[model samples]
Structure formats: structure tokens, C-alpha cells
Target: MSRRDSLPPLNPTRAFEATGRLLSVSKAADELCVTPAAVSRQVRALETFLGVSLFERIRGGLELTPAGARYLSDLMPLFSALRESTEGVMAGAPGRSNVLRIRSPATFAVRWLIPRLASFHRLHQDIDVQLTTGSAPLDFRREDIDAGIQLGDGDWPETHSQRLIPNELIPVAAPSRARRKGWKLERETLLHSLARPEDWTLWLKFAGFSTANTNRGMRYETSLLAYQAAVEGHGVAIAQKALVLKELEEGSLVAPFDMTLDRGGHTYYFAWPSHRPESKSLKAFRQWLAKVVR
Candidate 1:
């Protein structure tokens, strides 16, 4: 048999590559849309085929073996090159313009985009917007995503970035929570979204309250989780007022204080690669977003 025919399948190689790149089988599984067991098995099979240990267990997590470290150092550049070549081919392909992918934070995707998506659809029936939600910054050139709504200081170095909205954050809780606990704004157990640990402290400072434990709270990673906790009467959360506006209008949550903090330190921005073709659909979507925010 030839050397190429003796090698393991490409899928196993890909699994090993992703696992090595991320250094976590669970993360590799998430990225590949496969189960953790599957990723683990694939990695083990690859290790057996190569006759070397690729990873070692450390503190209940996986770490690369020295061999794996050297392998990854060699593989990363090739992987990047492959990604660039694939993107170039996809961009040049003809008759493949039915999808638009967008990356945004999970909370923003759930609370803001999902609610107003119907309107976007009504206006532009041709474009289908597929959302990928994560907290990580996207590489527009490497990924297949057409555009992204990013939350950060507007300093994307090499993309077309437009400010989507300026946000003000305030303390909020479910009406039930407020009613049942008889909790006024000053006496509530603060629940924090991990994205903004100092949110409660800043809001408290804005409200002229200088308590020492202003930062004490149940912390969550996403605003969606924070909102869920607040709705279940767990604790009060400091959230972007705009994100919770619909819930506030519907009385699901109430702002205990009228004070708002200027989070101009960061803002939401819509960004796309500067080199990509700007289609009519993309232009329409941008214009609609501009009008909605205005």
C-alpha cells in the first residue's frame, strides 16, 4: 500500500488538529458540532496511529505533550493558509449568494436581533441572516461570516465599522422579585453578568451610594442568564437598558432607579471586511439598521 493510503482518514486528522489548536476536546466538539466523546475518541485514534501521546491530563484539563506542542507549531501556519485559500475560493464562486452570516454576542442575538428579525425579513426578503453567537472577536477575512455586530471600543483596525447604538446601563429586576422581597434598589442582592463585573459598582456610584459590598452578587456570563435569574426573582442585575427595553415595556422587569450610566467606554458596532463585495442586500440591511437606531 502507498504511504497516503496507509494514513488515517482526513476527519480524524481534522479532529486532532482542532483539539490540538483549542487544547480542549469539549471546545473542539463545540466548534465541530460533534460530541466530546467523539472528539476524544478521534484524538485517541490519531495518537494510536501516530504512536505518540498528544495530550496529558493536568488539573482536570488537557495539556499538549511536547510532541503535540511541536506538531501544533508546525500545523498552525498551514491551517491559516488553508483558511485563507478557502475564503478566496468561496468569495470568487459564482451563483452562491443566498446566505449572510453574522456574528454577535449571545445575549444581543437573543434579545435584540431575534425580536426585530421579522422586520428585517419583511423589508429584505431576499437575504437570509444566519447568526453565530459568541463573545470572541471574529476574523472577517478568515471566517465565512459576512458581517458582525461587535461590542467593544470602536477600534477595529481593518474593517468597515459603523456604530450601531450607544447604550446606557441600569439596575433592573423582575417586578415579582421587587414585590416579594420588598426590595428597594438600595437593599437588593446584586446579580452580576460576568461580562461587566464593575457594572453594579459604577451604577451605585452614579446613584450616590458608596457601600463597600456593591460588587457582591451572583455572577453570570451572559445577559440572557442574568435576565433569567432576575426574572426568577434571584437578584437585581445591571443590564443595557436598550436590550431590556421590550421586557421593561411589558412589565416583566422594572428599573428601580432612574439613573443611567454612560457606557461610552464601549458600544455596539456593525463591521464587515473592507475587501468583500458589498451586495445590494447587505446595503439594504445596513440602511435599515441605521434607521432603526436613529
Candidate 2:
């Protein structure tokens, strides 16, 4: 038999592959949660068995040799397949209920979901929700996300989306800021939320104050930041009603004017892949969400 046929089982091969792909024994060790020396020893053993030098030392990091490159390319697909199969089996199993991964915008997750999560837990005690915040949209197949909360028009292609909240923007400021500046709505410095650039203009128009300068002010990327900025007496912010309701109720934020705008686009939406129906846990959570939001 050839030496390759007489080689040991695939554990050492996997270790080598992980180390080669990461290009650092330390990183591989971190992923495996073992010491760097252990990873180094495993890689050395694999090199001795294969009779090939797999990596070259560089200035700061290790670079793969030609042999190593070829080896990694061949094994990558195998690892990916193994991972997919394992995840598929785990996801399909009825007894083992893993976490339901959810992706959402950071501001929305922090301001909206995090506060209400306790109620969800109370309702569905068995379903564990794992939330990851990002600005980028998620690919359901590429990411193992069970559901997502998105802010946009209800027209996401190839996905099932349910409208969670209506779109309403209003001008709000910190109570301290309002108190310090006196209730002079016309002289209030505006803090802008980046998601809705035209919110101030629309709100101004709705309030019949068409002459106010809506474009000039400090801008923040998220409502959470805008809320914080307003609370710090920086400026007044145009905020979504759903996001600021708790703050308003608690006297942290105050809406001095009754003027509000009902923009047609940009509503909160609950979404998931259309092809994949919700699991029982996800369904229960979704139903609970509908009840709470309604």
C-alpha cells in the first residue's frame, strides 16, 4: 500500500487544514480553544506524516506553500459540506431545539427589540433568541438566521415580510433641552437621524411651518444615537414614534409639538426566507410579536 493509504485518520488533516486556512497556529488554536503550542505540534505532526513543508515563514505571518494551497483548496469543500450536513441534521431534528438567530439593524435591535425581549422570553420559554446587529442585509442561506427585522418598504424580493409597525416620524427633544431653551419650538436646534433625511422637512410641512431649515444640523446614523444626542441637550431629533415611545413616556424625551408625518415608505418589517417556513418556536415568537406590537 502507498504511504498516503497508510496515513492516520482525518483529525490531523483537519487540524492542518484549519491552521493553513487561518495562516496562524494561534488563530487556529483560538478557534479550537487550545494552546498555540498544541496547534503547532499538530501541524508539525501532519507535516512529518505527509513528508512536505506546508508553510513558509514571512515577516509577520505565515504564508502557504504551493502544496499547502492545493491541499487547502481540496479540503475546503469537504469541510463546508460536512458543516452543512451537520447543521442540516441539527436543524431538522425535533428534540434538540437550538437558538433562533435573528439579524437586525443595530439601532432597532437596541432601542426596540432588546427592551421587549423579556416579554418574548416570558411567552415562549423554550425558544432562545440570538440577536446579531448589523447594517447589512442577511442572506438566509449564507447565514444561519431564522428571522430578521428590517426597515424598508414591504417589498423584499424572494422573502416573506410582514409589516410590524406603521411609519410615523415626529420631532422630539430632551426634556432638559426643552426646559433650558424654553418652549420655543421655532428656535430649537435640530438633530437629524440619517435614516430619514427628509423627515424634518416632512414634519415641518405637516406642522404648517414650511419656512424652517430642515437640511442644516448635526446628523446621526441611527435613532439610538439621535436619542442620546438629544438627551445630552445637543439638539432636537426627528424620531420614529415606535422607537421613542418608551423614552417619551419616561420623560427622557419630549415631543413639544403635536405635528407628525405619515411617510409611505420605511416601516418596520419581520422577514424570513419565503421558501423556508417558520419552525414551531419561530412561529410562536412571531405570533407573540404580532400580539405585542398590535
Candidate 3:
């Protein structure tokens, strides 16, 4: 018989390893989720196969023999290594194609990251980035998504989060017809976004316009649409500073007021599951984002 065939079976070996190391059949049984009698049977089978005494009967329960102690010391590392190797293989099962799957909000994906993707692609040609859009709660267990960009207070449980940017609201309007500083507020038509309907209210209250009707504006489904409307000389839109930075810089839209509403506890974050071991590709992508954010 070959050496592999001559050795005791894995189940019996595991049984004996736990039984001998623990010195209590019931405790080992609890650990193994089997009956104490079943553990004893397996330990006996292992001893019979090896033709050696692995454990000895005691007054209270059992004790490991010197040989059993030595065997357990040798087997523990091997079992641990086997488990770790198996988990390591499974941890990276989703990265077989070297694709970095990222979930993000549609407006942020389009307005911010998409513009900077060309540089990311140029720098990391080997790492393919796949972007999915949704602002819903993130689930890292999904095979299609590895990580996500979230806008909130960064208090999500079971997640490792890195704050990318803070939420700052500023009033912006088209350069062509937007009223300059000190213009009458009642004269301008305020644009609104359904996504952030309270943005105008929040900013208005901060600016001491307590009596203004915040809900009375031409509402759009997204902030990007409102920003576009603002760019078309329609009216002022409460714009997120980061999203409208390019427009502000290029003189397409101008912040008519100097007051920017920076509410604490609201920030943009990139996050992934805390429990899952981060794959190398995901780590690289996260580091790249951290750099971009910096």
C-alpha cells in the first residue's frame, strides 16, 4: 500500500486531532459539532489505524498521551494552512477576469469619475474598471460589485470606508444671465432637484432667507439636470461644489453668492465590506481612488 493510502482517513484524523488536543471528548465534540460518542469512535479508529495509543482514559474524562500531544502540534499548523489556502483561493474567485467592479451613484459617476477615467485607464491598462450605477444600499457579496461610492455620514456598519469629499452646497447660475452679488432674491427663479429638494431650503436657511418658499421651484429628478438648467440661464440651482467645479472654473456657471453651505456629517465615501479580505486588484483600485480624492 502507498503512504497516502496507509494513513488514517481525514475525518478520523480531524476527530483525533481535536479530541487529543482538547483532552475532553465532549469539548472536542462540541467544537466539531458531533456527539461525544462519535468523536470517541473516530479517535479509536485513528488509534487502531496507527497501532498507537493517542489518548488515555482518565477519572474525569481523557488525557492526551505524549505521542498524541506531538501529533496534535504537528497537525494543527497543517490544518490551519489548508484552511487558509482554501479561503485565499475563494477570496479572489470574483477577480478571475482582473476586472474592478465599482458601484456608484449615476450623477457622481457621470459628472466626476467618468471625466477622470481616461487617466485611470492610461495608468492601469491591465486593470479593467466596470462601473455600475445605483444609490441604494451597497452589498459587497454581490459577484458583480466589489466596492461602492456612498454619499452620507459614513456610518455604515460592517464596512471599511474612506471619505472622498464632503457635501458642500453653493448657489450657481448661468454666466450669461445670472444676477451678480447683492441681486434681489425674489427676482430669480430657483431651480430644484428632486434628489436634493431640501438643498435649497438648507442653504436658504443658512443664508437667513427663512421666509423664502423652498419647495416652490421647477423640480427635476436629478441635480445634474438642475445644474444644466442653471447653465441655460433658467435660474439658480443649489449645486454641490465638487460636481459643478468644472462649470464654475470654465465660467459656464458662476456662484452668484459667496456663502457656501457646508453641512457637517454629510460626506462622500468609498467603501467595501470589512470582513472580506481585499483582493490585490481592489486594493489597487481603492488606493487609486484615494489618490484621486487627495
Across 22-137, the per-residue lDDT of candidate 1 in tens digits comes to 66889887777777888888888888998999899789788889998788767655665565456456555664334567889998889887788899988766567888888888
lDDT of each: 0.77, 0.77, 0.79
Q: Which of 1 and 2 is the better model by TM-score? A: 1
- A best-first ranking of the candidates according to their lDDT comes to 3, 1, 2
- Estimate the overall C-alpha local distance difference test score of candidate 1: 0.77
Model 3 lDDT tens row, 33-143: 777888889889889998889878989988778888788767765664454455456555765435677888878888898998898878776677889888677854322
Q: After superposition, how far is residue 200 of candidate 1 from its true place, in Å?
A: 1.3
Ranking by TM-score: 1, 2, 3
The residue pairs in collision within model 1 are: none
The regions of model 2 sitting more than 4 angstroms off are 1-96, 180-183
Which lDDT value does model 1 have at 85? 59
Clashes of 2: 0
Measured by TM-score, how close is model 2 to the native structure?
0.68
Candidate 1: count the clashes.
0
lDDT of 3 at 116: 86
Q: After superposition, how far is residue 145 of candidate 2 from its true place, in Å?
A: 1.6
